[model samples]
Target chain A: MTVKLYIDSIHDALQEEMRRDDGVFVVGEDVGVRGGVFRVTQGLIEEFGEARVIDAPLAESAIVGVAIGAAAYGLKPVAEIQFADFILPAVNQLISEAAKMRYRSNNDWSCPLVVRAPYGGGVHGALYHSQSLEALFHHVPGLKIVMPATAADAKGLLLSAIRDPDPVLYFEHKALYRWIKDEVPEGEYTVPIGKARCVLEGDDITVITYGLMVHHATEAARELEKEGISTELIDLRTVAPLDSEAILAAVRKTGKVLIVHEDNKTGGVGAEVSAIIAEKALFDLDAPISRLCGPDIPAMPFNPPQERFYMLNSEKIAQAMRQLAAF
Target chain B: MMNAQSLEVPAMIAKRHDKLGLTDHDVVKMYHFMLKTRGLDDRMWLLNRAGKVPFVVSCKGQEAAQIGAAFALNPVRDYVLPYYRDLGVVLVFGQTAKDVMLSAFAKQEDPNSGGRQMPGHFGSREHHIVTGSSPVSTQIPHAVGIALAARMKGHNLVAYTSFGEGSSNQGDFHEAANFAGVHRLPVVFFCENNKYAISVPLRKELACEHVSDRAVGYGFPGVTVDGNDPLAVYAAMKEAVARALDGQGPSLVEAMMDRMNPHSSDDDDRTYRSKDELEEVKSHDPILSFRDYLLDCGVLTEASEKALREEVTVEINVATTYAEKAPYPHPEQALRYVFAE
Candidate 1:
């Protein structure tokens, strides 16, 4: 097993998928010559020809629209949006065209494509580079939303997403790209979508999270362990078609729940999770379904104090857990 | 007017004969297509009135340009991405009369949509027709990609896309033209300028006199043709397709026509245009002019014309009955085809 980072897992998964399936190819700005801005697609143009590793114009909407058509035609295309924030330009295609193609057309067509983008705050990438918009996509039907928090999950989920017949938005947390590392499988393997994993098992309150927030949630759980909190941590793999079964089971055992994510509090995935708990496992809850989320703002600021205040962190998760346990 | 003043029409008509290179047989086939399309359009209106088909967009006056483009291509070879108004093109491209009628009735047998889509939303994977969404101008870039794919495969096959003048104002149109022109892909961008987008007139939409003129900005040959004249429209489409097949690049051909009906079954045309304007549009009807031309050229006799109309009437009746009898798609089908699974 190779100890690889999350970004490295993306590169390996893409290279392996491209080698395995002739129909699979990668397309986006700087994906060819530049190996992607984050270099997740490094050495791909060399391994696969330029046709397989296409470098498209900077037009975001064209990148998305072309991928949809190409996927419809025959080829399985994976388009990279350089930054998750910049994906707003192509949101029309994602929301209206790609997402609706399968449903509105009554399955006469399927947009079997992947749109990969780096998201999250920290690493000093201010404003447009750091927004978490997975919640926006998770609300839309006909699209699978993936946010990997580990190298292994990244590789497995990437492979699964590439092979999935439906359109998927694969959000790679830029903060976790190199910071988080794990032993990824050497060959082909895929983790099914809509499944969560127990990062840590405990008897006290359960902390459910994903993406970069998973790290913070884990850290919070570790710190709480010394105080005998014994927190159970669950890392959700895909937000849409979420692992509600796993979550409810965890909540039933731990008898308490605290949902955390990097996205804003208003209309975020946390609220949806809270609602799911209320609907299914309400009586099992020891306290209210607490949520630790980013402030209701666009994104984190460049200023250290303001940025730290805007985004959710380990301390916030720890504090939220303490408050929930007290209740 | 003299035939010479018509520039391309008479010459193009004389160049090809029966059974090959768009012969008299092909012309009659196209005429048959027009009859079928008009029959379907008329049936749709009746269905809507009778509350059988929920909605319909009748491509009545615009049949010539739509059918002409369809006649110019082999459906198995070429890909067509057309807007809602090209119901005639859908028929000419081998979408069955029954399939179209079933789609209008929202039945399981509707090959285009299988009861999921609105009327006139045509898409067929078997014929390589890319599924069209309700969003205007989104199909343009997809057509460009098809052309690009053809070039990538080193094939001479061309991808054809048609939309109205209203869609030309969209940014996707420019993106498609730019990509196709810059890449030198095999595509013919056909814009059927019916002079209105829903209720908005062409003059209010664009400052340019013709939509084709916008194509010059993208470094391709752009020409405007009399869309009401099937021969002229066919000639222009043939030239564009030939240019693309010869590896020259893409071309934009604007076919100027008029919409004789409202935007759709739900729209009321009388609310927007005056009686005189509607009458003027009717005078330039493509089907009438083409029939007159066929009569003058001795290609069609009065008896044959009457017989053809009756034949189309019978065919339409049969298709309607078939559509009405087709079962509704099972609700479990809702989960099916959401993916390739």
Candidate 2:
């Protein structure tokens, strides 16, 4: 195992997968000669040649639509949208075409494509650059949504996503791209999709989260450990096929729950997690499920103070945990 | 097959048909396909009015262009991504009359979607015809992608995608054209310029004169053909297919036709189209014009035409009855195919 930046793991995973499968190719704006604006796909064009690592015109819809067609024709294409906010133009292709290919064709065709985008606030990206769009796709049925918080999960989950038989929307939080680093296993290994990882285990309160919020929750869990409060941290790797069993087990053990995310409050992943706990494990709870999420504003503001307040941090998560524990 | 009787023809029509390289038997086959498509379209309207079928989108005046383009490609190798009103195209590409009836009835035997999608959403893996959705021009990029895949795998195949004139204004069309042009993918963008998009006329759809002219912006050749002349359409499509197979890049071929019927069974076209305008469109109906050309060229006689009509009537009736009696999918199977087994 070797420690690496969160973005390096993703880059390594792409290189490893491309080397493993000839059908696996990457395409997007600036992914080839420019090496992507964030450099996640740096040096891929030199290694894989232009055909495999294409730099497409700046059209999101065409990028995704072409990938869908390629996937249908037996090519596994990993397309990148420069930013999560720019993914709206390609939603029609993703939802109507790629997602429905398997179901509509009645198993005659399948689109094994992955669309990667950088999401979440911080780095002063503002409204157009920083947006958490997991909820927009969570309601879609034929898609799988993955947002990894750690370098190890990023590499493992991406390898799994590229090999899967359906379309996956993989959101890598921009804020955690370089800030987070961990020991990622070498060689080819995939962390199973639709499963959650228990980052830190405790007994007093269960905090279920994903993406960058997992780090904030982990920090808060460490802080609470000093105050005699035990918080169980669960990182939901895949949001669409929620790991309900893992969430329920955590709730049953802790008897208290707190769901945190950087996305908006309404119709977020937190709502779904709360509903699941309320439906099957309502009797197991000692206190009501609490949520710490971004405010219901249009988007993250450009101002430093406003953006800081708009994002969920360790201090806010710890306060929510203390409130839920006291309840 | 042509009958043993030698029928005479006017020299002018014979010269034109001969120039297209279509023999007597090929012209008759093209006529047969057009008639069959028209018969099926008419039956669908009857079924829609009788409350047997839910919806009907007619391809009445576009048969010549559809069949012309279909014949120009190798159905066994090339891929076609046809739009919702491509009944004639799908028929020529190997979808049987029974397949059409099954889709209209929304029966379990429907190959496209197993009764899931609406009628006219053509698809058949065995025939290499890609499935299409209801959206206007989404298939444009999909066709480019398929061609891109073919090029990557080093296959000498082209992808043919078609849409209405109004859909040419859609972003999917332009984006697809740009990508295909930049990559020089083996694709043919066939536009059936039916003059209207439901209620909107072509005047409102675009400020340009012809839809094919937009292909120049993507750095490819664009040609406009008289869609009423199957021979002319065949000539244009034949060249386009050859260029694609030769890896010369994509071409945009605009078949100038008209929509003779209302948009769908539910629409009352009289609200938008004038009686004089409808009469003008019907005057140049491609099926009738193609029949005249065949008769003038001695490829078809009165007796043979009568025999062909009888054959189509019987075929459609048998397909209708079989599809009507077919069963719906079992309720328990509704959730199947959502995920790979």
Candidate 3:
């Protein structure tokens, strides 16, 4: 039995990786002394020295660039951006250099670096703080984008991401950092990239989601069960190398599909999944595919009504399932 | 790799030919390389004009400095992370003129691109030259990275990367220099300050007196050399490379050369600058000054100089022809070279 382990999974992953490998080090603003704003890196500086738990200058590009350099030089660096929004400054390093290094160099050099950032909405992080920008990274090839929904998966995926040969952007939803916890293996384990897990299996309507939205979808699935509508909830563990087979199978069985993400409605991961379904399994669909996501403009405000309206919740997921089931 | 001690002084003087170098062979080689580079530049410009090639960032005025720097290290070992305007440096680092021409032509036979990259995006694994990209100052950190790798591997090899004055404005430049200094990596950050970034003057881009002065802030030794004088540039690079190899750390050396050509084939200087300004810079061309120094040293006689120019012209002409005749890459091959399977 997977015993319920209620702890900071990200912190657990960091501790495990740091202990497991000599090269594994964490570097970020306030990550060392302050233990990060959310305390994800708490007690790491005490465990490992300052060199391993580096307190870098407040330069995102430098942080990413230095990590790339360190990784190429044979150190496994887990660099954290205090917030996901501030990752823009280092976008070029991540997108251009880190992504294309292996491809352009013909695999002469591989950047085995992991950039961990706390992302997604629901903590009243506002515009600058809360953002589901995984789609932006998902669009770029040669990069692996992982957004773990569960505590167990978070530890496994974070470890795998650290060990992976290519650069991995491990986007940790700030909402799920401590809000949701389950049995995460105490020993070393890895969840394969490009594999989606059916967290809750049903056959009526398939709801594809990832990260914090997975929990939301599960809530919606339970609510739908009360109405005799069995919903299949899939958590897309890795966004970039998506598990098309799993998605195709789910669609084939359920004959109906609803893609949900915390990102903006237009051009979200749902759009890509929709396109993939259209391209591959259009005939398998029983009804038109639907997407439940934040309204497309920018991240919404912290106001109770505006936040409730703009953010996608279990209610929104249930609404989509009802509409899809009715069709 | 060749013995560093034997090549150090000669290579240094070869790099900065007008300085107090007592060697005649070094000056002659400097003249030869400059002439060779200038010839290639002239051919490439004509190729662009004649519609045989698409684009070029000519290294005509910066040959002496580029070649002198190239001569400072063993081409077989030290890795060079060159920029678009570093054709001369690329050639000196063991890339064939034909290979570079084919790259410019975007042919399937182009070693640099394999028909994937645009013209002047040069790279050669055989030459230990890391691939060049269009992004400004991106290679600065990569060079430091390679140096860091070499240092970790316990190989005393140095990484040399060069870019224009414009590239110094990039945040990557600052980051790479800072990290290299902090880690004491064996890397040389060569800033080819040609006074103008395209049409944007150095004054508009930088408030500092020279590009090298910024190195002091990064906690490394910085020096400004007469980039037009290959001897001075070579001397500076040798000193820097030696310091790095001896585990001293990275150093920044600004080569104050001239931007004789417009920023690239796509750019026209006449749109932004007067002919007077163009002529003023052209008068101090590195190739011309190096040629004069060779003549003074009696290393390059009129007959020899004529023969050398003819030889280089023919070599470049043959390369141009080979590039033109080379087949364009197949449409399906576009996705081939992105990564190694």
Candidate 4:
């Protein structure tokens, strides 16, 4: 195992997968020659020639629609949407086309396509770039959404996504691209999708989160340990098919639950996690379900104070955990 | 239907068929497909009126363009992403009359969607026809991907896609065309301009004179031909296919025709279109006009024409009965196929 950045882990997955399978190819606006805006696809085009590494036109619908076509054509295409916020333009393709292809065709056709988009806030990307749009996609049944919080899971889940037999929307938090680094395995590892990993085990309070928020929750859990407030942390690797077993198990252990995310508060991913806890683990809950998320403003502000207020950090998450523990 | 054997004007002769390398048998086969498409489509409308099927989107006036274009390509090697009104294209690509009737009936054996999608959403893996959706012009980019795959996989195949003229106004068409042109992929954009998008006139549908003209913005040659003339549309499609195979890039061929019926069974086009206009467009129906052209070439005798009609009618009737009797999929089966097992 070697310590690597989240971005490098994703890049290694693409490079390794392309080397492993001839059917896997990468396509996006600046994926070739320029690596990517976030450098998550660096060094892929150099190893795979231009035919395998494509720079598509600035059309999100075509990028995804063409990827759907290639997937139907029996090729695994890893299409990169530059940012999660810009994904709205291609929602029709993602929802109407890719999501329903298999169900509509009665399994006669399936698009084994991986759409990688960088999501979440805190990088000052403003409205056009720094939005957490996971909620917009999770409700669709035939689609799968994977959000990796650790470098190891980044490499592992992406490998699994490309190999999966259906469309998978892999969202990597842009804020954690270079900021988060962990010991990733040497080669060829997979973190099975729709599963969660327990980062820290305690009995006082349970915190469920994914993407960059997982790091913030981990930091808060570590800080609370020194203060005698025990915290259990579960990083939900995939948001769509919420790891209900793990979530219920953790909630049953702690008797209290707190969900955290960077997306807007109203109708965000945490609401679903909260509802799951309230429904299945209702008898086990010791207190009301609590959630910490971005405020219901349109988006994160560009200014520092407003951005700080709109975002969640270790201090904020620790404060929320402290309150939940006392309750 | 008026049989125009006596009106065999010299100018309406089959002089252009040989020049385009279409044997007499080939044109006859094309006419037969046009006839078959009309037969199947007509039966579906009667089924709709009789309360057997729920909906009907007629392909009345565009048979020549669909049949003409489908015959020009290598159906075995190429990928086709057809839209909702492409009964003629899918028929030529090997979707059987029974398969279509099954789709129309939404039965268990419907190969397209197993009774999931509405009729006209076509797909057949053995026939190399990619499954399509009801959304207009969305299949354009999918065609680009198939063409890109052909080039990448080193396969000698071209990808073909067709849509109504109104679909040309979609951003998907522009984006797909631009991407295909930028990469010089093996693709042919066939637009069956049948003149109406659910009661909106062509004048409101496009700002340009022809749907093919938009291909110039994407760096491709664009041509508009009389869609009622199967030989003319076939000549254009054949040329476009050859150009795509040569790696010269994509081309746009627009077959200009008319909508011989309302947009669908549910629509009342009489509100927007004059009766005279509908009657005028009906006079140029591709299925009828192409049959006359085949007769003028001496390839189709009156007796042979009768034999073809009998053959198509029997085929359609058998398919209709088989689909009408077919069992529906178990309601529980709808829970399956969401993800690969």
Candidate 5:
């Protein structure tokens, strides 16, 4: 195992996958010599020629649309949308074209493509640079959404996403790029999609989250231990096809549930998680299911005070856990 | 297929085909596909009116442009991403009359989408006709991507995509063209300028005089040709294809045609179009003009024309009957194909 930053693990996945499959190519803005906006695709251009690592024009729709077309032509294309907020321009391409390619064609054609973008707030990126838009794509049927909270999961999940037979939207929390590091396996350790990982197993209160929130929740859970409250934590690696088996099992173990996310509360993925828990595990709950998400404001502001208010921290999560633990 | 038309072509008309590397048989085949497209389109409209089909998007006046450009493509080696009114293009590329009918009838056996999408949403993996959606100009970038793939794979192929003049104004068109131009991808952007985007006229669609003129901003050569003359359209497409294959970059070929009918069966031309303009469009119908040209060249006689017309009608009728009797997909099938099993 090699100790690597969360972003390097993702870079290793792309470089390794390109070496493994000639059909795989990269396309995005400044993904070439400039690597990516976050250097996630650094050195890919030098390793594989410009043909494989394309520095695409500044058009999100075309970036994803071209990837969809390349996927249709039997090529594995990894498209990057620079930022999750800028991905709105490609919503139609992902929802209408990429997601519907196989279904609309009745299985005659399929798009094996990956659109990776960095998401989440707390980096003072204001509105455009920092926004979690996974729920928008999570609502789509044919598209799969994944947000890994660790370097190891990031590498494994990214490899699986690229090799998956359908389109996948990979959202990386920009805050975890260099702040987080973990021991990553050397080669070929793809964590299967549509599965949730259990973290900090306990029996007092249940906390379900993914992406950057997973780390914050872990820190919060560790602090809750000092208060003699055991927290059952789950990191949902794949958000679309939720790992209901693990989630229900976790909820059944602990009677209370608290869903955490950096995205907004109204119509967020937390709502879907809440619905699922309420549907099957409602009877098992000792208290009402609660959701700790960003406020209903349009987006996180750039100011320090408002940004702190708009963002979720381990302290805020610990308070929610304390409240849930008390119940 | 090379019977009287191949031998009886006059010297003047033979030069038209020879200069473009097309044989008399090829043009005859083009004519046949155009007729079949028109017959099937008319049949679908009739079915819609007769309460059999739900909707109809007629390819009435655009047949010449569709078939003409399709003749220049390498159907087996290349990919063609056609728009809604591209029945003629799909027919030329290998979709049979029965396939078109099955889509129109939305039967379980429909190869395009198993009766999922609308009839004009044509797709066939066997024929390399890439699946398309209802959104306009989205296929332009897809075609560009296909070309990019071919180039990366070191394959000598061109990707052809067609859209209406109105769709040329879409952002997808501009982004796709700029991307293709920057990469110098091997793709041909064929714009069938049918003069209308539903009820809106071309004058309001763009500030430019022609759709081809917009290609200059994308760093590619753009040319416009008469859509009524199949030979002219074929020549332009052939040149574009040659440039793409030679790695000179992409080209935009715009073919000027009429919408003929209303925007669709649900539209009312009387509400928007004038009778004088309609009469002028019909006076120079592409089918009639091509027939006259063939007759003057001694390639098509009145007797052969009657026989061909009857043949097309019979094929369309048989396809309609077969597709009409075909069963619809089971209700449970709607949930399928959402993800790969």
Candidate 6:
């Protein structure tokens, strides 16, 4: 195992997958020579040449639309939307074309494409750049949404996403790209997409979250532990196909649940998770299921203080956890 | 300034057609497909009015352009991403008359969607025709992507995509044109400019004179031809296909025609179009003009035309009966194919 940054794990996964499958190729804006804005695809152009590592024109719709076509024609295209916010332009292609290709064609064709974007609100990206779009896309049927919190799962989950038969939206948190590091295996390994990992095991309250918020929840869990409140944290690896079984199991064990995410509370994955637990396991819950998420503002503010207030940090999570634990 | 008959079949029309590598039999075959498409469309309108089908999007005046362009491409090798108004194109590309009827009936045997999609959403994997959605111009980028893939795989194949003139204004068209131009991918962006985008006329749809004029910004050749003449559309598509095969990047071929029918069963062109305007456009109908051309060239006789019409009618009848009796998909099967099985 080698200690690597979260971005490095993603890069390694792309390299390994490209080496493993000839059909795998990368296309996006500045992905070739510029090696991507975040440098996650750095050195891929030299290794794979210009044909495989394509630098497309600054058109998100074409980037994804062409990837869908390529995937339909038996090529595994990994398209990058420079920022998750820019993915809206390509949503028609993603939702109408790639997502429905299989069902529309009655299994005669499938789009095995991976769309990777850096998402979440940190680093003061503000309005356009800083946005959590997973909730907007979670309702889609054929598409899989994955956001990994740790470097190890980042590598494994990305590999699995690339190999999956359907289109996968792999959202990487930009804030955790350099801030988070973990030992990822040297060889290939995949974290199953629809399974949640038990980040912290406890008996009092269960914390269900994903992406960078998982770390904040973990910190809050640690703080809660000091106050004699045990917290069980489940890092939901994939959001679309919610691991309801794992969520219910965690909820059954703890009886108190707190869903944390960086996206807005309304219509977020938390709502779906909360709905699932409320419908299936309301009897097991000792306290009402609660969610601490970003406010219903359009986006994160430019100023640091406003941005911090808009985001869900460990303190806010701990505060929520304290209330739920006391209840 | 040329009259419809003169433009349809001039004295040297046969010689010009021969120069383009089309035999007398080939022109007759093209006319046959055009007739079949028109017949199927006419039957669909009738069925729609009689409450047999849910919807009908007629390709009445666009047959020559669609068939002409489809004839130029190697159907077995090349890929086609046809818009909804491409009955003739799909027919020429190997979608059978029965398949069209099945789709119209929304039957379980429908090759396109198995009774899932609306009638006009044409697709067939075996025919190398990419499926399309109802959204205008989305297939343009998809065609560009297929061409990109073909070039990357070192395959000598072109991806042909067709859309209405107004669809050229869509952002997908511009993005696709720019990408194909930048990559020099093998693709032909064929615009069947029927002069209307669902009741909106050509003048309102574009600021420029021609849809093909926008191709210059993408660093590709753009040509506009008379869509009423199959020979003209055939010539344009032939050049576009050749350019694609020679790795000369994509070309935008805009075939200028008129939408003779209302947009669909749900639309009323009378509200937006005049009686004189409709008659003027219908006078240059490609099917009738092409038939005249064939007759003038001695490629089609009155007796032979009658026999061909009879054959098409029989074919349509058989397909219609088969599809009408075909079962609807089982109610429980609605949840199927949402994921790969």
Tell me, by DockQ, which candidate is best.
5
Model 6 lDDT tens row, B200-315: 88889999999999999999999999998888999999999999999899999999888889999999999999999998987888888888777766778889998999999999
State each model's CA lDDT, in order. 0.85, 0.91, 0.82, 0.90, 0.92, 0.92
Residue-wise lDDT of candidate 5 within A1-327, one digit each (tens)? 999999999999989999999999999999999999899999999999899999999999999999999999889999998999999988888888999999999999999999999998999999888899988888889999999999999999999999999999999999999999999998898989999999889989999999999999999999999999999999999999899999899999999999999999999999999999999989999999999999998999999899999999999999999999897
Where is model 5 chain A poorest over a 10-residue stretch in terms of lDDT? A87-96
Candidate 4 structure quality by residue, lDDT tens digits, A31-132: 998999888778778889899999889999999999989998989999999998888878989999999889988989988999999988888877677898
DockQ ranking from best to worst?
5, 4, 6, 2, 1, 3
- Give the per-residue lDDT digits (tens) of candidate 1, residues B83-195: 88888887777788888889888999887878888887778877767788788888888787777656555656888898999999887888778777876778899999999
Q: Which residue runs of candidate 5 sit more than 4 Å off their true CA positions?
A: B1-15
Off-target runs (Cα >4 Å) in candidate 3 are A1-27, A33-36, A39-53, A69-77, A102-110, A185-188, A303-305, B1-27, B74-77, B148-157, B181-184, B337-340
- lDDT tens string, model 2, A1-102? 999999999999999999999899998999999899999999999999999998998899999999988988989999999999999999999888988888
Tens digit of per-residue lDDT, candidate 4, span B1-341: 22353356444453468788988888888888988998988889889999999998899888988988998888888889998989998888889999999999999999999999899889888888888888788889999999998788899788999998888899999999999999998899999998888989988988889988898999999999988888889999999999999999999999988888788989989999998998898777777777777776678888999999999999998999999999999999999999997
| Model 4, docking class | high
DockQ pick, better of 2 and 6: 6
Q: Candidate 3: TM of chain A? A: 0.97
C-alpha lDDT (0 to 100) for residue A27 of candidate 3: 75
The DockQ-based CAPRI class assigned to model 3 is acceptable
Better of 1 and 2 by DockQ: 2
Please give the lDDT score at residue A62 for candidate 5: 97
Query: Ten-residue segment with the worst summed lDDT in candidate 2 chain B?
Result: B1-10
lDDT of 2 by residue, B138-220 (tens): 98999999998888888889899999998999899999999999999999999999999999998899898999889999999
Question: Once superposed on the true structure, which residue ranges of model 6 sit more than 4 Å away at CA?
Answer: B1-13
In candidate 4 the C-alpha lDDT for residue B188 amounts to 95
Every candidate's CA RMSD: 2.8, 2.6, 4.7, 2.7, 2.6, 2.4
Error of 5 at A260 (Å): 0.3
Model 3 lDDT tens row, B98-153: 88788778787887767666666777777777766788888787787677656645
CA error at residue B335 for candidate 3, angstroms: 2.3
- Backbone clashes in model 5, listed as residue pairs: none
Give TM-scores of chain A for all candidates. 0.98, 0.99, 0.97, 0.99, 0.99, 0.99
